[model samples]
Target: MITRRAAFCLPALLALPARAADWPLRPVRIIVPFAAGGPADGLARMLAEVFAPRLGQPVVVENRAGAGGIIGTGAAAAAADGHTLLFGSVSMTIVPHLQAQPVPYDVVRDFVPLGLVGSTPFVAVVPASSPIRDVAGLVAAAKAGPRAITAANSGNGTLSHLATELFNARTGTAIESVAYRGEGVLMPDLLNGTVALGFLTLSTVLPHIRAGRLRALAVAGPARLAGLPETPTFAEADVAGLEVDGWQALLAPRATPAASVERMAALLQEAMADPALRERIAGFGVLPASADRAAFAALFPEEFRRWGDLVRSRGIRAE
Candidate 1:
């Protein structure tokens, strides 16, 4: 003989199993906002390889490159299913402020930061035969006259462009900037001395520097890079308050359950802690610096504000 209260609780108890189903009911999709063969794509694929076995499901990497990561990122933010995730970079913070029209998604509201992948410092490089040997030399030449030094960037409002702008602002020099479609287009001009200097990812220019085609005068980070130990950092070179590092992180749609988010974060943290995995990521030219969900959530707001201020102050606009 069941009491009235027990009868009322039976239906709820019976539904618990269905309500508490494990996440990843199907294959998980990791969206890379940039094109394949880039740093962000590489990171996503590496993460997927580790996540597949941990989550007991397939983890697929999807490249949805367009508009400097806006299209793919917006798609990820709008995804209703928890199965889709985004592998984003610093451009996630920078792109919103760059657009003239209103952006479709909100960085602070539309998605939850799952974990931070890693970061790589940008290296300031010039042709090996160029007369500019260091940051000071570059500054002195730029201050000598208007348009004295021409710097090339991958695109308008890109990390490379902002880095050059930050250098000019901090050092009180006027280095003219030339924008190219992408790094592939900019590399030729940089190597041939058509452009005076450029800030590029360490991985992209490390070979050139080692092969005697380009000279790395300074790196953009708080400390010097291990691969370019001889090169000083921007702060070390007397240009204080000019630190920038290209970082990548994972994000999920806002509607995703907290349990799923936590599970993914735990899995990522465990994978990032593996020494063998760290060595492989380091080989790709980025430092392995993984953060759990809470840390990543705190980091996003700070970075968003910092990049927003820089973009507005420099009057940077999209092309």
Candidate 2:
């Protein structure tokens, strides 16, 4: 059934992969949309250090931080060449939904998720001295006087803010959500009991929790974290729909070749297998990931839709 024209085209189709695989002709840059000192920056630097030599080119980590990472993210989206990649985070899905005007690019439409890097779950915490010892007690207290129990967040429209809102919605407690400039300011107030409760990252609150300044009531992850082994998950506490695992990933421009994307994802899996790197990532209370491209494809879009639904339902807007 092979026609003369079809036979002529078969050879060209077979050669496509060879052309697509010819990428990273020069140095590759991983764009960290956040500021220079945060988790994305640190992780990207670590990845660059491990992945550069094996890639047969230099890998650079560039910080294009601003507008809560939109500036850098937009820049990466416009990069048609395979040389530029994005060190993306939970904020990507949240930002577009929270913005008043539309952001420069659509995450799902403009970029292809390369692979998952890691994830950290938000933990619900009260001051060590709080009488709210468990999830039930916290909910009961918040319900008693919704105004009395304030939930502190890093800022409006952040994952922390949305987590707080999600908890309130699920529990039927209209607890006031307070915004701090960032976790640094929120931490001092949280320890001093100026803020009643906050759903914060373990990395930001783990030391304080260990020193007995913060009481971790429940974890909003699939299971209890290794660092906080004794804390129960929200579902275990009879509270459902509070799960939120803030994830990290790498993405490339949508126009990048499929072969290049697969190769980069393979490199990520290999790097994640490194014991030293895994230890370093875990030191910050993050779980290292080695998921393949298909997994990444499934995760990112669901996250995008999930956060969008929450933002719209809650009327969450950027600060």
Candidate 3:
């Protein structure tokens, strides 16, 4: 009953287009800038375990480890596809500014913050025997003897050093930086009162704090940490803008598709929501990531700028 023109149109309408494939056609390689066997590397493996079976591909963490993470970060910056990701840290925002030479990538320009993992705050800690019991007390003591108070750090450009710099700037005090080979040597000095103070990683100092070997004055975070609820945040302690912590996160190359990034972010948040994972992370004195991706990403630029200014002004070097 169809007319000749109608019959001719029916064939064109009946032709079907081919289906498009799902994303991540192959294994996804996650680059960790630090060396293996470290806490960061351990966390990366934990995440990869969650991602691999569900991602429909093998998820691998590759440690590129050198130049304070510049080597692997540069490799991540050069990634051309969504399959390559970076399990970066607060160091990504820091190490570049510490370099006298220009880094291979710009933190903001080269990558987008994919998701937040967690952070271990820098606690203002003193030997249990010290008289200082709070931020005000610590500040007063430092002010009493300018440049006489010792703040321990593993090296010149580490987060501990930067936190000490920020604390000094915020409190209008000058505490001298005391460098150590690593925490192994530094912890003993702190225990024996050879070092008066340290803005140290909570995980590294938590046991000591709990064991009554070191006293935590204030935690550099938005609010009091669950592990140290009695310890107030810097703001609550009357020191605003003194928050300092080493955050762990994922970032993707900027050129990666927006859809893919969104999907990955959702996946990360879902993984972070696991109660067991959060508990495990918290057991190490690290706080679990919040569900707010936008809020977390919004913080990156400010933190990046803050650390950069401090690094440049302090003339921090890699050695």
Candidate 4:
């Protein structure tokens, strides 16, 4: 009788949806919670270019920028259709905790993690003509004149700003921050010798560094990136607490069909596994990372816990 009951229960359990395939019945939208042309935007476009044809439906990228990406991300979270997905970066994890009120969306409860796309190192850069040539020199200059260094950040409470703040807190130096609408604007000023220094993604700053328009002082990562081997890692510069990476990720609305998430995740993994796609994106200094349904599901809670600690401990507030 026990064996009979077990056999009956097994069939019922196995009858439940297994997420094997048969997803994406129609067109899909990928929301990028920032302006076009940045790292997140580029990543989304690349994925769309590769995913649309394989999925037999068009994939579109929509840019919804504002309020440190809250406006756009909130829109994505509220999307009712599983066909709509969010392509976001560190801000998706950072903003909710840093805001005084609850953010527009709950990072832990409102979205499903698809997986990390990739991460790039953060570069401490200044205008090429600036007097501070390196991390040590910048620290010394800031010490001599407190809040004298004007650093440009695309937004308040962003990874770039947080990285800069972490550095300030560790080194005990004051760096007055200048907020910008976007990196496109900041890069020009950085190239023209307007801002003293700032933390920007390596992929965004790499060309300028090569062009000799901006000076890279250090890279913030676990180890120095292969392309910029000569640049010292933050640890090498003795800049404690100067460890943070810029990342991109994919997210779906909470409770999206498991089958839908699984199918998209599989296609994404296949797309990333393509050698040409990997090579082209890697040339931009961003690596490709993909995860399956179960692993991807675990990312949001972990990121929420980690970033929430940093925001609370550091008292980072949205400006």
What is candidate 1's TM-score against the reference? 0.91
- Candidate 2: stretches off by over 4 Å: 1-21
**Looking at model 3, which ten-residue stretch has the lowest summed lDDT?**
15-24
RMSD of 2: 3.6
| Alpha-carbon shift of residue 242 in model 3 (angstroms) | 0.6
Per-residue lDDT of 314 in model 3: 69
Per-residue lDDT for 289 in model 4? 67
TM-score winner between 3 and 4, please give it: 3
1-319 per-residue lDDT for model 3 (tens digits) = 9999999999887653222235567888899998998878888888888888777889999999998899999999999876888998898889888777899888888998877888878888999999988888988989997686898987888888888988888888999999997776799999999989998988888899999999999998888887888999999989999888789888889877676677778888999999988887776667888736797689889889989898777667777
Pairs that collide in candidate 4 are none
> Cα lDDT of all candidates, in order?
0.88, 0.88, 0.85, 0.80
Off by over 4 Å in 4: 1-18, 35-39, 63-66, 188-194, 283-285, 290-302, 309-316
lDDT of 2 at 125: 95
Write model 2 residue lDDT over 1-319, tens digit each, in one string.
9899999999998767534356668899999999888888898898999878888899999999999889999999999876889999988998999888999998999999888888987899999988999999998998896476998999998888999889888988888899998888888888888889999988888889999999999999889988899999999999987888879898999877777887888888888888999889877678888757788899899999999999999888887
lDDT of 1 by residue, 121-154 (tens): 8999999989999988998888899989999998
TM-score of each: 0.91, 0.93, 0.90, 0.80
